[model samples]
Target chain A: MHDNAVFSHKVLPFFLLAPQLIITLVFFIWPAGQALYQSFLIEDAFGFSVEFVWFENFIYLLEDPEYWNSVRVTFVFSAMVALVGMILALLLAAMADRVVKGASAYKTLLIWPYAVAPVVAAVLWWLMFNPSMGVLPFWMDAFGYDWNHYVNSGEAMTVVVIASAWKQISYNFLFFLAGLQAIPRSLIEAAAIDGASPFKRFWQIVFPLLSPTAFFLLVVNIVYAFFETFGVIHATTLGGPGSSTKTLVYKVYEDGFVGLDLGGSAAQSVILMIIVITLTVVQFRYVEKKVQY
Target chain B: MVENRPWLTVTRHLVLILGVFIIGFPIWIALVASTNSSSEFVSGLMPLWFGEEGFGNFRRVLTNEERVLGVSVSASWMMWNSFIMAMVIAVGKIVISILSAYAIVYFRFPFRKTCFWLIFLTLMLPVEVRILPTYEVVASLGMLNSYAGLTIPLIASATATFLFRQFFMSVPSSLMEAARIDGAGPFKFFKDILLPLSVNNIAALFVILFIYGWNQYLWPLLITTDENYYTIVMVIKRLMSAGEGNIPWNIIMTTTILAMLPPVIVVLGMQKLFVKGLIEQEK
Candidate 1:
């Protein structure tokens, strides 16, 4: 606690952090700064001259119809996946919470998908959703239903959503299970003594208290959907069947990386960053207040 | 929270079991599809037994034949690349995080708040924003098609640093004081006492980063232009496409199963620590 000891502490920390800072700056911070710089201009595929065009890249991005389509698809995918993923996780968590025996086995089985790489998951889902040879589609035909994901945009969205949800369900379950265990047993017993209906008791007691955990899952899931679904979108659809599956991240990758429009890509990245920062700020500032924690 | 109402007991059981089955069904089908032959798989039969096609499917998967899109040599190489990159990144992250976290927790530095908040800000910027510029940096470093390109950049992990910093801050200050009074320096104090006590945090970070590395798609896809640099996931994808002859459902599924095995084994093996590790952070 003395001045010399405290000051010495500074030296060690600075030395340890110095290498990491340079690395982070060279790799992360500076790239992000460069992306910000590039967003103001236009450039060729190989990133040649990059003539500064002021706000023209932003103007083009905002006015583009494909860009808007991606925005809509992104939010829809995020909402459905996050909301459904949370509900399924909550139910599973509640169920796992009540198991008298073999809880570990159930937990092991349920959380396995969380371990599967998204790339592999994308492959599995792609093979599973294949029209002719896909197991699910085969079953659909066997059961006397015409199922074609290619023609139906809803079905295509559903396929990706299900794949996404399958992975998220396990994660949500793990977190929710932890949150469930953390809730004291005495609280539920008190609710019972008040003669609250089972449904009412859950809504009034469990749901409200569980909001913080739910909010945690919600933010994570939204972020996961927003950014992480790129591989699946790339492998399975390639934004195909008339570009129905293209989301925000994919759009950025397409414009920025694929189209070789470095400025446009950089611009998209900036917009994406702004949107994420704003959403995160909103989550932390307002909705987080309702969370019990 | 325990419910006094017995109704929840049955309802919970029903819902949980049902959810488990639905969750498990697709995987079951995947396993089944892997077991059967191409014809049986295409037929989508429900019968499950040791089929004559199991070995046949294996042969077709490993060998190039009629209707069999071969699992490329790249599968093995990519798996190795991914495994090495993932392991190094994981170990590097833990070490860097330990030092950074220790400092943030035990020291009173001037840029302390700035360092901590810098990590928080990075968390919000997902890989997409950095993909373009990070690509430029990686390519410029001449690390393209090299292991350094895959692993080194990933070594600067903000998430791990943040998690460890947060977790270490919660360790009782008394432990550090006791060690310090014994004339133990910061490094000795951390190595001997602090690190040993934080196994659960280490395990949590390991599981998280392992999955992150396993699932890293865009980075690998972009960084390595060569087929040899592709991971198993990419291998499966490249094989399953229509151009490489008939995309065997069985071969693809088997490849998928193979791709999934390590991570599945890891999760199942470490399932106890998986939940316990995360929950421990709450305390």
Candidate 2:
């Protein structure tokens, strides 16, 4: 794919590239280097004295139960978001795929959620389940079920998960719908002529063909649930109901900004960087394979 | 049409309607809440229907005279900030990305791969992960509470650059040869031929990047301590955490509606380009 017949420019190309390279160096690479350096040193209380603590910051984080809880919470939260979001989107996309009339209307109705900001999504759901004057809680009260997320850890997690997952459904649906539409119509018709049930055809033929799209969306959704959802948690729970919804990204912000634990937060940032890099690598590998197909 | 199962078709419509309902429910609730008066919420059940105060609420939120209504900054002011930030980020990202991509693809530059890899390194380190140091750097540079502080650090985009690079590579090399034979230099070819060809790609990227910029929350929340620079998206967080009394669901909902309106319109209006840019990013 390389363009061998290129212009032989000397300083012009460098001039063109300077803005991006400069910003990347100053904003991205510099700060990342600082975070890595700060992760290895512990600053004193007054911000005056500092001591190099090598692996101590990481060791302390690893030993801390709260950090472990955050890891558990992150994985659990991401899993629920990916599963709930992807499954619901797959159902909707499959249905929309099957329908001929009003498919675009259904699409227009569905994909608007992708435009709503994460914080705005949180606010929408927060209003719905407000526990006092909320619509859902008003109905739940009749069934003898309490609906407060402020006090219940599980409910808090559920609220953020729903807000996060709801915003993601539109994206997953777009991909899944595209994937579904790309499958050959004759394949399904051929299977139906053989007397295979619709359910069997879907599970065997459609789903197997859609696995590539499903896999791509899985990685994308997990990355979204991990990092892009900082606003969702920050605005609503603030990682509260006693740190129940404090995923790794939120914990990094809380520790670094609010708690002002420079060394520990930097260590956590390093870990998150590793996670993001891993996810990017995995996504690119899948994408390359997908391009071939 | 694959099978003549009538029941299955009905089920499909039903499922799609249900999905649309669930997806549209929150926006509906937000819309309904924005229409009613603040005192209406005192009676413990949320009203599911439209209220008489719809026009008044939107007018108040959109007008600059509503600062005394407990929202320190007017919704209009915040929305203006959001618009500026979004436009700056989107336009800045596109300009820088296209330039760098053109440099890498069209010309033989030294350390070009190194520069590309350096830009790629930013894909992993989002603002959320390296919050403190990035803030420190921005603050030290005297960029806090300004538009530059809000948009510049985020303008260096790897995805946009990569997208443009891929597009540039696919452009037939013969086009460049023809341009060169016609006495056009690199810049002349880029300006005349390449730019015209890339207009569609630029438009598609603009739609996606505009929504991305408008929906930014954390970065603005970090840098913009002054209410003058508060984006509409970031303002909601402050409004929610203001206090315990009254909660002001009407004004807040109105603000939420206003905040989401532009991006929602963009996404709905440019549906084709939006979807293309989204899938293009992944590809």
Candidate 3:
């Protein structure tokens, strides 16, 4: 009964948490666990009742070349998006910081890309990048590059990466600008007084202080690349140009929802979860420790 | 003032202007696209300015088979469905996370640290991992295609819990103590004292969660398959691959513009809240 008092104290909290717990278990945990479990099974594509076929879905997925391709695709896409996104965001944020006036107006303009839905952004870019009529293509042909994302896998991948990065750079800029503003101005002044070159001061002092924020954004940008940018890929590339841009998430959508291979798709989803969890664990256990608390 | 450097200042302004134009141009395209007629769009050329076809395009988008929302394609049904679903999730998350955070942060509690880490585990196991089984679980519960199935499964928001804990931990303990000293019960102390202080966080959290829920394509696509149950995003996606007869760029752009409204409004409206909440990195 002594333990009951603590429970009683939690009565109010229990009420508050109950709804969240119930919903989380229902919507969040259940679907994910279901996906993981089904990854091991082979279900009739048409019907619900089926024999419990264990590990068959996974084995089949392993043999399917597309499955392995998706893993590689997910990696390359995420790496490119995350790395390029961080650099662009940092540069833009740095530039924004140096503006003498109308900083808010500049930020508002800069963040407009983030405001558009991924579908709209993709479509907007699609229209603007259309080879015959797209502004970029139209302008580039004046210089004779003959750029078109529709036919070339590399070009398609480049478009996907650029679009994803463009959307994300605004978010990163917001985070980094906030981070930069939070940094003490005195440190930079001191570095300048010591006759440190601007680049050296940025590398040594500013970059180190920005590590925690960078670390936080690394996790965010990685996840965004994994889950969020699927819309962009779906709308923009449709995993096209010979499956060059076929990301794991896009594959999951195509296989499970589009192709009716729910079991096999679940297997890929499980792999995605594993890669992300492993990355996160590594971040917390190793990289996070080095983040200077 | 006499010491001001001209070259650096001019260079900075130039960079800022270029950045602004890059970021601003796409939106200009979207806004302009809405104004364009189908003929104008297909003519292989569109000026940066408006085209006066907004009404006509809006009509076609809503009436076309490709219409993703409203009474037409039953996507409007999904919008309301999503709005309700997201609200339920938002309310559930905010209440649970804040109270849980309050329990751990403001009070002496047993196993509080363990609870913290346990909740954090959800952050690792994403909805993507367990989505298939959760589908079965909902099906088993006979909640398939039901409102409960759509809303309940993804309700445990690790992000909300995490943010709330961080916010609550920063709150001064003296306030809680004073409320307790005033004979306020735990409930009163929590409700009367704690919840008010966290309103800004709640607002920020609400916008983020709402947008996340609103934009969800995979989960909703997987769970609800009925024509009457598609979300706004689902509609846009469904319209994307339609036959050549239905791929009207004008209508697509119009509906796309429509779909963009809620998140845009939410973000623009709560700009200050989001700005305040998202603290910049300290150097």
Residue-wise C-alpha lDDT for candidate 3, range A82-130, written one tens digit per residue:
8998987887787677565888877776664555556556766766776
Better of 2 and 3 by TM-score: 2
Query: Lowest summed-lDDT stretch of 10 residues in model 1 chain B?
Result: B41-50
Question: What are the runs in model 1 whose C-alpha is more than 4 Å off?
Answer: A1-10, A46-49, A142-144, A282-293, B1-10, B39-50, B56-74, B243-245, B279-283
In model 3, which runs have C-alpha deviations exceeding 4 angstroms? Answer: A1-13, A46-60, A283-292, B1-3, B59-71, B74-86, B106-118, B140-148, B243-246, B280-283
Where model 2 places Cα greater than 4 Å from the true spot, the runs are A1-4, B64-71
Q: DockQ of each candidate's interface versus the true one?
A: 0.51, 0.80, 0.41
> After best superposition, candidate 2 residue A109: deviation in angstroms?
0.8
- Choose the strongest candidate by DockQ: 2
Q: Is candidate 2 or candidate 3 better by lDDT?
A: 2
Worst 10 residues of 1 chain A by lDDT: A1-10
Residue B37 in candidate 3, Cα distance off native in Å: 1.1
Per-model CA lDDT versus the true structure: 0.74, 0.90, 0.70
Query: After best superposition, candidate 3 residue B246: deviation in angstroms?
Result: 5.8
lDDT accuracy of residue B42 in candidate 1: 49
- The model with the greater DockQ, 1 or 2, is 2
TM-score order, best first, reads: 2, 1, 3
The sequence of per-residue lDDT tens digits that candidate 1 reaches over residues B247-283 is: 5666777777767777777777877776665554333
Winning candidate number (TM-score): 2
Between candidates 1 and 3, the lDDT winner: 1
Is 2 or 3 the stronger prediction by DockQ? 2
